[model samples]
Target: MSENNCIQYINCHCYMTIQSLQIKARMFSRISLISLIMIPVIWSQDWQVQYSSMMKCALKGSNTHLSGSYKHPNHLTMIKTFWIVNPVKGEETINLVDHPDYKGRVQYSQNKDGIFFLSLSNVTHKDEGMYCLRIVAKEDKYLFFPGIDLKVTELRVEIPEEAVEGKSSILFCKTTCHLSDKTNFTWFKNSKRLSESNVSDQLLLPSVSTDDTGNYSCAVTDHKHLSSPAVTLSVRYPPKSVSVSISPSEIVEGDSVTLICSSDSNPPALNFSWFKENQSSAVGCGQSFIISSFNSSHSGRYYCEAQNKYGSQRSASVSLTSAGDQKAVLYAAAAIGAMLICICIFIVVKKNIRKTGDAGGQSGVSKQEENNSTAVTDQTSAKPPKPADLNESVYASITHSRPREQQRDGDEDEVQYATVQHHRNTRNTTAEDGCQNGNSVSAGSNTEKADDSNVIYSSIKSS
Candidate 1:
């Protein structure tokens, strides 16, 4: 037959087979019968089977069961069954009774309903294949079921022995089972999904770096089925992202400051060197540089270099200055000193002025008291003061002494009188002693009156 005619005949046959299977489907709800009828049409029409493959995922060294079915309606009993394996060598057929290749490791059985299955024990990489069942009816008719692709994937991640930064590296999602380019693959790094479902089995890192270094794994697109355990990927590179830090961001004079250096590298930064701006050589070494006492000498722009076996990197400059509080404190102290001095000067000046006023007031009071005493003395003595001392004016005068009055008798008609000086320094004046006949005669205490001018007329009696 011509190719076109053969194709047309195959199509016609497939249509008739589908119609027959559909008519019988109402009699039986079993899905195996319908699939068996359509398997031939599917195989002939499409070289690339569009139907999803029956996936049987098993771990290495585990037992698995692969199911296949071929059922027919009345007057059709299964006479013989065979299994076909598509392996690397080619397509192979194994009889259920005595298969030499899988002698004791495999068991095959068919139930009364015409469903067939096989159990593979201690499955290994070599046993992975596309399996199908071929059924022979008692009427000598034959049927083939669609394949149950047994994928005994020993899922694992393949990593390069050495990965360098800024270089390309590839990670492979390895499996012993045959996988096509259309198979969906999932990649994970550090348990995080790297990308959505992809068709490529290999994950490419255009430039492997520290960011790409992590635990990696792969899985089939179906989340229910996973491929491999995670493996680690390490990338080696020079020290990078160098940084410098101060323990206390604010620095102060007389305070100890700690300088820390850090960098990101695969082998880690093995050496650290500290440098100051405008300096020709490194000032310090190690991961940390300590200043026992910070000062202007320690204040400058500083940076650090981190080195490893690969290379070195320098950090950006960081500036350090004395804490502002120091200047503030100084200013405060100076101000306080000035204020204290001012206050002290004010108090001292006030005390001196008070002393001077007290002295002047006491001197004036002494002079006034002296004048008052002289005036009191002059007035009490009933004498005028000296012209140089004070001018005295008599408002009222007090008598120093008083004498008693007495009555004179006619027989003794002589009056006695005495003269006295008011002050011890004053001269006494004698009163004129005058006496007349028929008048009273004045008599002195010590001497008798003589005449009118020299002795007063005495009172003479008739006797």
Candidate 2:
């Protein structure tokens, strides 16, 4: 009995396999039959009491049944039968029904064919023992040697001593006795089922974190109400989701400033570090850093690191500035704006100047025209223009006083001629383009030729 589990026995520290235990169940016993009113041991053939099994295991808080069959000689009448536990070889003991320890928890059934069954309900660790059957016939008794061994076990949620975050760990639902491979195990967390038969032996927890902390328990599938005692699952590591906040969001020169770091972790993070945007090393270390008087040297983006026994994490960066630096930035922006405005105004003024120069050239041309008109007025003649046709006829009449006798000869018909100064016609030229020329027509109705003494008359008309 050394190859199997044996924690159920109080004195025995070893266990035997089912095959070996069954062989052991058939131990030698002195069983005899006797007639009524004649108490004497009568040798008889060996009795046959066969059990379904000799070694049995069950989960705590569950029930187990032990069944067996018996055969005896035809001459004896069966009186009574019962079951006992951890009994002496020949000494009589209390049956399971009357035993103080098994009150209200034991049941027995027997058929007329000499077969019987023993049922143990709500089995517990204290109930672990060797059980045997007894039969009484005509005041003589017999003890069935060897017996069934019963063991009770429960599930446990087992974990490693140092479970860490972001790491894998296997948690076992264990029992001291090995149940059949077909037996199913159930896992629970805070009264909620996590898995069934598929993950009965162990639960694989990956990337453990603080959020995974909780109470865990397990039970055999059929004995679900008898779940194992709750075991707490805790995960530990460095800080996470680290972040920094700057008090008084707007920074000003000579103003006090504070940077505070925060994170989520188990057992709390105790170390912290502050760093500038481009610097390779930390500027300070603690939960918070304070600057009594801000300046340009501290005006840069910064972040912090949070650390614990497990590891460390860095926070998001923030920026800081002084009042003087802010004002300088504003001044430079204003100067650029003013310079752009001036350039735009200059371009507009240049365009207007070009337009004025073009208009002035047109006015100058009009003034030159006025000057030409005035010159023409100064030299214009006061007479209208004469007809310009050369074919127009000029007629003249002349008279001559004849001597006494020549008068009688008709000399009065002598021809007369006169000179004419011609003027241009207005129909063709307005006095030589809008002004009269100095030349004029000067002929009188009765004019004397400079070479003739007698007066002559002439007139000109366009035909």
In order of listing, the candidates' clash counts read 9, 2
Q: Residues 222-287, candidate 1, lDDT per residue (tens digit)?
A: 431455899999999999889988978878788999999999888898899999999999999999
Error of 1 at 36 (Å): 32
RMSD of each: 24.6, 23.6
| Candidate 2 colliding pairs | 1-15, 253-323
Off by over 4 Å in 2: 1-45, 73-76, 88-92, 111-114, 162-167, 195-199, 206-214, 235-238, 248-256, 266-270, 292-296, 308-311, 322-463
Q: Which candidate number maximizes TM-score?
A: 2
Model 1 residue runs over 4 Å out of place are 1-153, 162-165, 176-184, 190-197, 209-214, 221-224, 234-241, 247-255, 293-296, 321-463
Taking all chains together, the TM-score of candidate 2 against the true structure is: 0.56
TM-score of each: 0.39, 0.56
